[model samples]
Target: MNKIEIIARRILGWKLNRWDRWYDFEKEQFIPVSEFQPEENIEHAMLIVERLKELGFSYKTNGTSGACFGDVCETGETLAQAITNAAYSVADNSSIDEGWL
Candidate 1:
């Protein structure tokens, strides 16, 4: 899986359902949440930020250099890349259910 997917399923504890999907306001169309790439879509990316907030963490990005969550900070060329990388920094991907362990 990709970085955003890993962050969603592993770090965010997302369990997929058949009905999993979302509406893209920007594109004005429906899309599968399972296929949502938060790094490329700002709205969906905000959802990740909100989820992180609910999880008792805060995020900050310079929009050009990097983003940070708690004590971990990661740098990237773009804001989206930076945020995604930072979020993925906390992912525990060694789970048997995810088939990576």
Candidate 2:
């Protein structure tokens, strides 16, 4: 697996169920609550969410779920692929050294 795939699976708790979605511990369910949403940009948003959590920031979906259709990329990659790419980008751009961990 690529670096992004590792991060998404190990850090973000993404599950592969036809596509990819984050597991919500509070709700004991997945967000977006849909088997498919052609326009959702969940992949990238999930990464951002995890980063915020790491920074001691908190958030709630507030009963709202789903991403904007406009956020979807034209590359035709699945949600999982998108998330993997996002993770790789983050890891590549991060200033923090992995050796610290």
Highest lDDT among the candidates is held by which one?
Answer: 1
Predicted candidate 2: what Cα RMSD to the true structure? 9.5
- Model 2 scores worst on lDDT over the 10 consecutive residues at 67-76
Candidate 1 lDDT over residue span 7-75, tens digit each: 766555554444575444434665677567767766666666776777767887777868887767888
RMSD of each: 6.4, 9.5
Q: Compared to the true structure, candidate 1 yields what TM-score?
A: 0.65
lDDT of 2 by residue, 1-101 (tens): 55644444444555543345546453476744243222245645565556535744343432233212222221224544443343444444456454421
- Name every residue pair that clashes in candidate 1: none
For model 2, the stretches where C-alpha displacement exceeds 4 angstroms are 2-4, 15-22, 31-86, 89-101
lDDT of each candidate versus the true structure = 0.65, 0.43
- Runs of candidate 1 with Cα error greater than 4 angstroms are 18-35, 93-101
Instruction: Report model 2's TM-score to 2 decimal places.
Output: 0.29
